[model samples]
Target: MNEEKNKGGMMSVIAALGANVLVAISKFIGFAISGSAAMLNESIHSIVDCGNEILLLVGNKQAAAKVSDKHPFGQARAKYFYSLVVAMMLFFAGGALGVMEATEKLFHPEHNVENTWLVMGILVFGLIVETVSLRVAIKEIKALNKDGLSLYRFLRESRHSEILIIFAEDSCAVLGLLIALGGTLLSHFTNNPF
Candidate 1:
C-alpha cells in the first residue's frame, strides 16, 4: 500500500483510535462513580470502537504485505475481512450488551446513576471527542471523493473502508452520547435511572 495514497485513511483511523481510547477511559470512570448503565454501555461501545480501529490497522498492515506466489492479487481483501469482523464485534459485543443492559434496567428499575454531574460531564466529553473524530473521517473521505458527489452517495459508493468505518463508529458514538445525555438528564430530573 502506498503511504501517500492511504495517508488520509491512516490519519482517520489514528484519530478515531485516540478518541475512542480517551472516551472509553472517561466513561468507565464515570460508570464506576455513578453506576449509570448508560455510562457502562457507552464505555463498552468505546472499547469496541477502539478494538475495531486496531483490527482495521491490522487489516491495513496485512493488506500491505507483498504479493506471494500463492496469491498473485495481493491481500487487498484483508480490509474487508477485518471490516466483517468489526461488524460482528459491533453487533455482538456492543449492540448485544447494550440491549441486555437496557432490558435488565427495564426490569430492575434502579437508580443506577448516583452522580449525575459526573456522568453528564463524561457524556459531553465523549460527544466532543467523537464529533472531532467524525469530522476527521469526513474530511478524509471527502478528500478521497473526487467525483463531487453528494455526501450520501459518496458514503454509499465509497471504497475506502478505513475512513468509512471511522466515520460510522464516530457517528454512532456521538449519537449514543447524545442519547445518554438526554437519558441522564431525564433520570436526574425524574429521579428515575431506569
Candidate 2:
C-alpha cells in the first residue's frame, strides 16, 4: 500500500510538471501577442503553477525517502504540508491578483487589450494539455485505491496535503481558463475591455 501511494505521488508530480510547462508557455505567448490583462493574469498563474509543480516534486521525493527509527511513519506528511503552501500561494498570488487587476481594468475601461487568433490557438492547446494532465492524475489516484481503500473515504481522509493542493490548483486552472476564454471572446466581439 505504501509503495502504491509512493508511485501515485510520483506520477502526480510528473503530470503536474508537464502540464505547468505547457500552460506557462502557452499563456506567455498569448500575453505577448495580445497584451490582454486576462492573458497576463493567466501567464502569472501559469508561472505559479510551474513553481508549485517543482515544490510538489520536491515533496514527493522527500516523502519517498526511507523511514528511520526516529520517524517510523516516514516523511509522507511533508508532501501534504508542501502542497498546502502551494495552494495558499495560488489562492493569494494567482487568483487574488487576477481579480484585483480585473477590477482595475473595470475602472479604466479605455485600456485597450489587443486580441489575435493566436491567443485562441494557444488556449485550445493549453486546454488539451491540462486535460491530459488531469487524466493522468486521476489514473494515479485510481491505482492508489486498488488495495480496497474506499475511494470516497480515502479522498476524504487522505493526510497527504499535496493531493488536495494539486486538486485545488487544477480546478482553479480549469475555471480560470474557461473564464479567460469567455472574457477574451466577449472583448473581441464587443470591443469592451472588462
Candidate 3:
C-alpha cells in the first residue's frame, strides 16, 4: 500500500513537471513576441517550477536508497534538504524576479506590448494546463488520504512531500497565469507596462 501511494505521488509529480515545462516554453514564446514583463516573470516561474520538480524527483530517489555502513539510518533526510532548496529557488528565482520585473515596469512604464492576443492566448492555455495538473495531484492525494479529512486539512497534515509540492506549485502556477492575463490586459488598454 505504501508503495502504491508512492507511485501515485510520483505520477502526480511527473504530470506536473511535464505540464510546467510545456507552459514555460509557451510563456517564453509569448514573452518574446509581446515583450511583456508579466510574461517574462511567468516564464521564469515556470522554469523554476521545472527545476523544483526535478529536484524533488532526485531527492525521492536518494531518500529511497538502502542504508549503508556509513549511514545506518539511510538518507531519507535528503528529501527535506531538497525541499528546502526548492523553497529557496522559488523565492529567489520566481518570487524575487517577479517583484523586480514588476518594479522595473512600474518605473519605466514605456513598454509597447505588441501581440497582446498571443500573450492572452498563452496565458489561457497555461491556466488550463496548470488546472489539469492540479487536478491530477488532488486526485492522487484523495486516493492516498484514507482519513476522510477535508482537502485543506489533508494538505496541511499530509506527509507526502512530492504531492504536496506539486499541489502548491500548480496552484501558484494557475494564480500566476491569471495575474499575467490581468496585467497584460491592463497594460494593453492603458498603454503602459505598469
Candidate 4:
C-alpha cells in the first residue's frame, strides 16, 4: 500500500513537470512576441517549477534506495533537503523576479505589448494546463489520504512531501497566470508596463 501511494505521488510529480515544461516554453514565446514583463516573470516561474519537479523526482528516487550497513536508516531525509532547495528557488526565481520586473516596469513605464490577444490566449491556455495538473495532484492526495481529513488539514499535516510540492506548484502557477493576464490587460489599456 505504501509503495502504491509512492507510485501515485511520483506519477503526479511527473505530470506536473511535463505540464510546467510546456507552459514555460509557451510563456517564453509569449514574452518574446509581446515584450510583457508579466509574461517574462511567469515564464521564469514555470522554469523554476520545472527545476523543482526534477529535484523532487531525484530526491524521491534517492530516498527509496535500498538500505545498507553504512546507512542504517536510509536516505529519506534527502527529500526534505531537496524540498528546501525548491523553496529557495521559488523565492529567488518566482518571487524575486516578479518583484524586480514589476519594479523596473513601474519605473520605466514602457509598454511594448504588440499582440495582446496572443498573450491572453497563452495565459488562458497555461491556466487550463495548470488546472489539469492541480487536479491530478489533488486526486493523488485524495487516494493517499485515508484519514478522511479536510483538504486544508490534509495539506497541512500530510507526510507526502512530493504531493504537497506538486499541489503548491500548480496552485501558484494558476495564480501567476491569472496575475499575468491581469497585468497584460492593464498594460494594454493603460499604456504602461506597471
TM-score attained by model 2: 0.81
lDDT of 4 by residue, 1-194 (tens): 65763464787899899899989999899889878776787688778788889999998888777778987988877777887788778777677777887787678765466787998899898989989999999888888888999989998887777787788888888897788789878888888766
What is candidate 2's local distance difference test score? Answer: 0.72
Model number with the top TM-score: 1
Q: Taking the tens digit of each residue's C-alpha lDDT, what string does model 2 give over 135-165?
A: 7766766666655677567667765556656
Provide the clash count, candidate 4.
Answer: 0
Question: Global lDDT of each model?
Answer: 0.81, 0.72, 0.82, 0.82
Model 3 ranges with Cα > 4 A deviation: 31-41, 189-193
**Alpha-carbon error at 60 in model 3, in Å?**
0.7
Error of 1 at 41 (Å): 5.0
Give the 10-residue window scoring lowest on summed lDDT in candidate 2.
108-117
At residue 149, give the lDDT of candidate 1: 92
Model 3, 18-80: lDDT tens per residue?
998989999899888777776787787778788899998898888778889988998877876
Candidate 2 vs candidate 4: the lDDT winner is 4
Worst 10 residues of 1 by lDDT: 1-10
Residue pairs with clashing backbones, model 3: none
